[model samples]
Structures are given as C-alpha cells and as structure tokens.
Target: MIEYHSLREASPEQTIAWMEVLAENLRPSDLDEIAATSDMDPLLSLTTSVMLSDMAWVITSNDIPVAVFGCAPAGPAGSGLVWMMGTPLMDERRTAISIARSTVPYLRQMHQRYACLWNHIDARNEKSMKWLRWSGFRLLEAVPDYGREGRLFFIFARYDPDV
Candidate 1:
C-alpha cells in the first residue's frame, strides 16, 4: 500500500536525498536557488527556518521511499505548486492515479481564487503532459523559458470535475 508521508521536519539526510533527485531535473538557474550538495547548510537553514510555507511529501511502501512530491499547503486540492516529481524507483509500484488524485482537494478549494492551479511540464516531457491530462487538468498554454535554452514548458491547470 502506498502512503503519504509528510516531511515537515526533514532530516539533513532526507533533505539532501530529495535535493539530489530534484536537482537532476532542474534548470541551471533553478539550481542556483539552493545550495549545492557539498554546501547544504543554506538549504537546511532555509528549509527549517520556516515551516516550509507549503508542504513536501514522499510516497513510500515496504519501508522504502519511492517518489517525492511537494506543493503549497493551503487552499483547495491541486492549488499549490508541485515543486518536483520523480519516476518511482520501484518496478511494480505505479502511483499515477494516486499521485494525480492527491491534488483533488486542493484544486476544489482554490478554484475560485485563481483561474486554476497551474504546473509546468518540460517540452520534452510528453509522458508528464499526458499524465496530467489523464488526471483531468487541461492544457492552458506553452510558456517559453526566458532564462534557459530549449526549456519550453506546457502549463497545465486543474479543473473541477463535479461541474
């Protein structure tokens, strides 16, 4: 069974692990926002200085961490930002539905506040775009990255299903 485990007070080891996976997928400028692994003091100082204005979680099963996801904590489901999402390390574990479903409550709660909760998908990440669409988020637009090369991204926003 997959479970949502909060990392509200993540240890240095956990934070570094999360940063390692996320850094691999981020742009150079984005990478500069936090310190490098060799110098993790800034990250830990920044991370624990506040209660993570939002939230971060890891999906684990059988005592091993498989996937990591984070977002702002308030509002309807799906309203917060999804900072990073990585492919699960387990071969048999597939959590697409649950991963997508996790944002439901946030989407509904924050629907009226913003046009919709948005996420950016790398232009080359067709699988992620398809997964978001399958999860019920509609494509809004493709935005060009001003700072990076070949980093065009598709912005997807979550919508109401009951309507």
Candidate 2:
C-alpha cells in the first residue's frame, strides 16, 4: 500500500538519507555534473521541508519512500509548477504508476485555484516520461535551451478546467 503524508512523520536524518538514495538513483552522485550543465535549483531539502511543513507531497510504500513531488504555487491566479519528483524505490513500472496516480489527488487538493499545472520535464528522463503519461500529464512543448546549461526540456501540463 502507498501512503501520502508529511515529512515530519519521518526524522530529519531519514529525510537526508532519502536524499542520499535519490542522488544515487538519479545520478550516481553526479548532480555536480548535471548542475554544471544546467540551472539546478537543487532545493529539495528546503523544498521537502516546505512540503512537509506545507507545499509538497511525499509518497511511500511499506514505509519506504517511492517518490516525492512539490511545486511553487501558480501565482495569484494561475496554476503552479510541478517542481520535482525524487527517486523511485524500484524499477518496477507498476509501482511507479501506482505511486503517481495516488499523488494527483493530493495535488488537486493542495492547489484548487490552478486550471493548469506545468513542469520543465528533463529531456533525458525517458523512464519518467513514460510513467508521467500514465499519471495524467501531457507533453505541451519542447522548450529548447530552457535550462541554465542550454539543454532542452519538455514543458508538460495537466489540467481540469472544471476543477
């Protein structure tokens, strides 16, 4: 079963530990390399603090983190950005799909004013792209040179005008 909850539920040390795992899963400790080529905000620790305190959502299965996602609110009248998604607990596609579906309702609950949600989806993450599609996000545009390092990225959005 997947659970969505606050960061306070876990210790700070545990959160930091999650970051270590996330770093390894995503880059092999090579964020410096990615950062060098792009504008890596890397505010995850701070972001997670904000989410746990108030802005993001953390997803776990069997008490282990499967994913975490948060975003800056959409200005006063607009929808917010889908800031980030942390490590996947396993390469099991169904698990990722489950975690993502469980997460969307939380997002809608968190931001009711937003008509559209957007993300600067990294071009290199094809695996993530597949899972994101399963979760309801749609590819909107390819914004070339969007990152600080001049790399291209996809702008994805998911919205319900009725909501």
Candidate 3:
C-alpha cells in the first residue's frame, strides 16, 4: 500500500536515509539538473530541497519511501515554486499512474494558497514536461543557458484564475 505522510512526521535522519537511496536512483534528468544548478551532491541537494520547502510530503510504499515533493515560496507574493524528486520505484506503471492521477488535485489544493505555481524543468526531461502539460501547466520559453552548467531548461507554470 502507498501512503502519504507530511514531512513533519519524518525525522531528519529518516528523511536523509531515504534520500540517500533515492538519490542514487533518481531520474537522469534530475541528476543532470542538480549537477548543473548546484555544487551540492545529490544527497545534499535532495535534503536541502526538503528542508526549504514550506509544505512537503513523503510517499511511501509498504513503509519504504518512494518520493518527496512539495512547494516553496517564490519571490512574489502568492507565488510558489513546485518540485518533485522520486526514486526509480516510482516508475512502476501502477505507481506512476496513481501519482499522475493525484497530481492535478494536489496542485489545485496548492492553488488555494498560491496564485501561481512555477518551476524550471530541464529540457531533456521530456517525461516531466509531458506530465506537466497533462496536468494543465503551461510550458513557456526555453532558456538555452539556464543553470550554472549552461544547459537548456523550460519554464513551466500553472495559474489559479480565481486568485
């Protein structure tokens, strides 16, 4: 069974332990993005992201963490930067399907507090881009030199009209 838990329920050590394994199996695009954007190693990057997020959740399958995702305050008021990182276990068809179905509703809930949810996705991450489009996020311009390593990236966003 898959279970979702608030990050608050997870201890720092537990989060780190899960992240250490997840980092090793992170999607290639995620590994590349991290390499381009920060000096931190995969474990550090994943841990830091969790720590900075205002609201986050851990997805566990049968007690083993499979993913961590959440949103952080962006520069403007009512704007947030959304992000997700998961282990290869999430690639299982059943798990992927379930998470995909839940995504839109999760974003809608986030929209209650954030008028705009945005993030930069590595251009090579076609799977993520497709998922974002399916989730109703608009894919804006692509930046040729986006990160410290000067790789390509696309800006993606979803806006709440009611806000």
Candidate 4:
C-alpha cells in the first residue's frame, strides 16, 4: 500500500539509502549543490531543516521509501516553496500521476497562507519542468549559473494574491 510516512519514523541508515535513491535522479545542478562532496548531506539537511518549519512526508509503497515531499517558507514572509524527490520505481508513470493528484489539496492549503508558491528546477531537467507546468506552476525566468557548478535553473511560480 502507498502511504505517507513521517521523517521521524525513519532510521539514519534508511534515510541515507533514500538519499542515495534521490541522488540517482538529480540533475548536474543538484550534484553540484554539495560541491560533490557527498550525496547524503544535502538531502539530509533539507529533510531535517524542513521538519521544523513545514510539513515533511515520506511516500512509501509497501513500506519502502519511494519519495519525499514537503513545503517550506521561501524566506519572504508570505512566500513558500514546495518540493519533491523520488527514487526510481518499476512503474513510475502511475506513481507520478498519483503523486501529482494527491498533492494538489495540500498545495491549495499552502496557498491559503503563502501568497506565492514556487520552485527552482534545474533547467536541464525537462521532465520536471514539464511536470511543474502541468501542475500549474508558471515559468518565470531562467537563472544562469544558479548552483554550485554554474548550472542553470528555471524559476516556476504559482500565485494567489487574494491569499
């Protein structure tokens, strides 16, 4: 069964293994985020840091970690960011569709508090860009040399001024 697991329930080793799976899908920009020093540190830091400020959920299938999803403030008082990273699965197409649909309600709730929600996706990750577009985020601009290795990234945003 697929379900959301809290980060608190994961052991250190399990978390590291999940990070390794996530690293396998990263774009060059993601790899450069940690100076290529270690794959585990960046994600570990992200999961831990976000746990305090926002919601963190581990997506699992039959108790196996398949993905991690969460939301956090975007530094600006009324802005926020949402993110997700996942491991490869045999049937990713179905999994992706399920995740996209399941997260909409959560994203909508986040919109009630944060006037703007956004993400910075590596420009080279076409699949992600397309997915974000499908999920209602608009591409704002391309940021050149945005990450450690001078990788380019695209800023995607969804706003609700009424919020």
Which prediction has the highest lDDT against the true structure?
3
lDDT of 1 at 155: 69
> What is candidate 1's TM-score against the reference?
0.57
Ranking by TM-score: 3, 4, 2, 1
Task: List model 4 lDDT by residue over 1-163, tens digit each.
Answer: 6676656576767766765665565444444444432344656645554464466667777766666767788768888887765666413788777776776776787788888888777776666666678778999998887755576777889888889
Task: For candidate 1, give the lDDT of residue 134.
Answer: 67
Q: Per-residue lDDT tens digits of candidate 2, residues 49-113?
A: 34543356566677676566566665445676665455545346667667666666766764575
Q: Which sequence of candidate numbers ranks them by lDDT, best first? A: 3, 4, 2, 1
Give model 4's TM-score versus the native structure. Answer: 0.75
Number of clashes in model 2?
Answer: 3
What lDDT does candidate 4 reach at residue 127?
A: 63
At residue 113, candidate 1 shows an lDDT of 48
64-85 per-residue lDDT for model 3 (tens digits): 7777888988868999999988
Per residue, candidate 1 scores C-alpha lDDT tens digits across 55-107 of 56666555445455555544554354444445334223256566566655544
lDDT of 3: 0.83
Pairs that collide in candidate 2 are 51-56, 74-79, 74-80
**Which stretches in model 4 have alpha-carbon errors above 4 Å?**
6-43
Cα displacement (Å) at residue 161, model 4: 2.8
Candidate 3: 10-residue stretch with minimal lDDT: 97-106
Which scores greater on lDDT, model 2 or model 4?
A: 4
Q: Estimate each model's TM-score.
A: 0.57, 0.71, 0.92, 0.75
